[model samples]
Target: MPLNKTLSVLLLSLISGGALAAEAGTAFIALPGKAMLADAVRLAATVTAIDPATRTLTLQGDNGQARQVVAGPEVRNFAQIKVGDRVEVRLLESLSLELKKGGAGVRTRVDSVEAARAEDGSAPAGALARSTTVLADVIKVDAKTHSIELKGVSRKLKLKIDNPEQLKQIQVGDQIKGTYIDALGISVTPQPAK
Candidate 1:
């Protein structure tokens, strides 16, 4: 499936039929010509309902909020998830941007995907990761508003910079190379024997 579609539904998949490794944190760093930001979320949602026919699972959060997520093709162990089973999901994402002061303004791209599943077949356990990188020109930078605009081959982005000092360090003639990464992991354990 498409990246956008996969990311949108993977949360529910990770909660219902999908499982994550359960790690959480958030951090940000900035330096000359380089900056990085990362975020992670860990969740434990109960499998409240399951529809084998439609391959859908309903999950309820601790706050009583509920969401239904359809198992995607990536979910090969859908049958392993059962109602009452505790599903833990961890989603981690990061973005890094580096400045190439006098780059050719040449655009480039790279993409990759990696995944693995449990070999023991004891329970559903897996991890999926994807990454993308692009080089874009600094088409515009408004120091007054602390905003910088980047233009790639197929897309353009205008982002606000919270730090004024960081915004004043770059100019429109430079190239900014950015990398975005996202990963999801899931772990499903059956209810304890009563």
Candidate 2:
């Protein structure tokens, strides 16, 4: 997907009430189009602590508030999550006691999850690497201007060929990897790594 399109989808999700917020005061806020927070919630948090025996996790928010959450058997190993690692928790169901006007019923539904990185690292889209570089595959080659249109796994990129010699060596279906300085330009020379 293109970055802009992905961002648009995310924004639409947020605007349509697909996101939820939980505060330290034990209050949950729901966004617009989706179900209630207790209805359908999408929360992002960090793992502060974990108990493998109990299958529980102590998650903290960016604001420093913490909550005790339990994981199901589907979660293979709690050890995979480290302390301070950001995690996205989707509240699928809550069986808490609620006082309603008519009657009481257990709540069960599906929700979304969004996780953020704990610290900034030089990794391509969260991959493990010391130095990361953005890459794009050539989608279209303009022989006239010596420019190429490329698309990555997550974004569409356009690159200008300052060196005609290097551009002559490139062709359609070629993969290029380089440091992106701007939308249509590269800071470093691209090489065929893959």
Candidate 3:
């Protein structure tokens, strides 16, 4: 066989096996304090309290871990978050958090928040009035019920699909955009789009 053909076969085999295949090498996992301050860490916690004016959030993990997180202006609307509610947050380099809700549990301060508005075109002010946009990667897909498992920042989310056909188009490696609405409960609508 030609060299290129041989290489393609090997690559195909690797992808078919699994993306996170066990390898013979030293793998390192860092704990929260062990990592540098600039490093992003995801923590799942319950909202214990919220200081609206100060924009500080107090969260307690299901296992009893706790931390205070700050929300930035880019978050748009932090006032909607409530005490005793669950939330997932992405921490930016400026030490600000982007609040995301509707996951397995509450997650906080794991990564930077991308800008909400599209850069290619201008959006009318308040165009995204009722919803918050999230960029997440699909971690798991359930074809049976048309639900998808997503990982945003440090939190895992299971989103229900309004259009089963749209869900069918999603693959594990696909990236997704989710719209989150806050009401008596947090709800997420994720669609498979570039």
Candidate 4:
């Protein structure tokens, strides 16, 4: 039997609820002893079918790709979906690093996660936020090659400095403070009948 369609549930599965986004492998800001990289992506898929029985779905992408997907148990509130609805996905990623002094002088790390969903259930929406901070000692620096060795909580990391001038501000015995953040968010909205 052909399954009922509400296929954007697949997009819902992809969204996983958290944040806007960042570009891949692109540095947003770079300076001596400091660097930042971040990017974001937003996508919307139009729903073409909603069977309301088997949780099947048909969705069209911006590039005109259409595919079917089965909504698994991980998908919540599928009953709220309908044909002509739109599912949106938002993603964000960021990283920042700096060499500083006057730290505790020991390797350390911190992690955090946050999530939220729509309370009234008018629509399917959720988001998740995650972050981590790491403190490592600058054990070695190679000015010629623009490289540095960092001793972290459990191991060492070798990093190459893209800008030579940025390397000049760093030195051995300094504390390297770094923070990375990522977020994903998803939502569904009804469309006016046309």
> Considering every candidate listed, which one attains the maximal lDDT?
1
Best by TM-score: 4
Pick the winner on TM-score between candidates 3 and 4: 4
Steric clash pairs (candidate 1):
13-18, 14-18, 19-185, 19-186, 19-187, 20-185, 20-186, 20-187
Candidate RMSDs in Å, in order, are 4.6, 24.0, 23.6, 6.3
lDDT of 4: 0.71
Candidate 2 local distance difference test against the native: 0.42
In candidate 1, position 2 carries an lDDT of: 52
Cα lDDT of model 3 by residue, 1-194, tens digit: 43223323423332343321221222233232111112222223456777888777666655565566554444434555566665432221211112222233322222222223212222211111123445666678788877878777657789765455556566675655544332111111222245
Ranking by lDDT: 1, 4, 3, 2
- Each candidate's lDDT (Cα)? 0.77, 0.42, 0.43, 0.71
Expressed as tens digits, the lDDT of each residue in 30-115 for candidate 2 is 22211112233345556668787876667665556666655444333334555666554333322221112222122222223333
Candidate 4: where is the Cα deviation over 4 Å?
1-27, 72-76, 102-104
lDDT accuracy of residue 11 in candidate 2: 30
Worst 10 residues of 2 by lDDT: 180-189
Backbone clash numbers for all candidates listed: 8, 2, 0, 23
Worst window of 10 by summed lDDT in candidate 3: 182-191
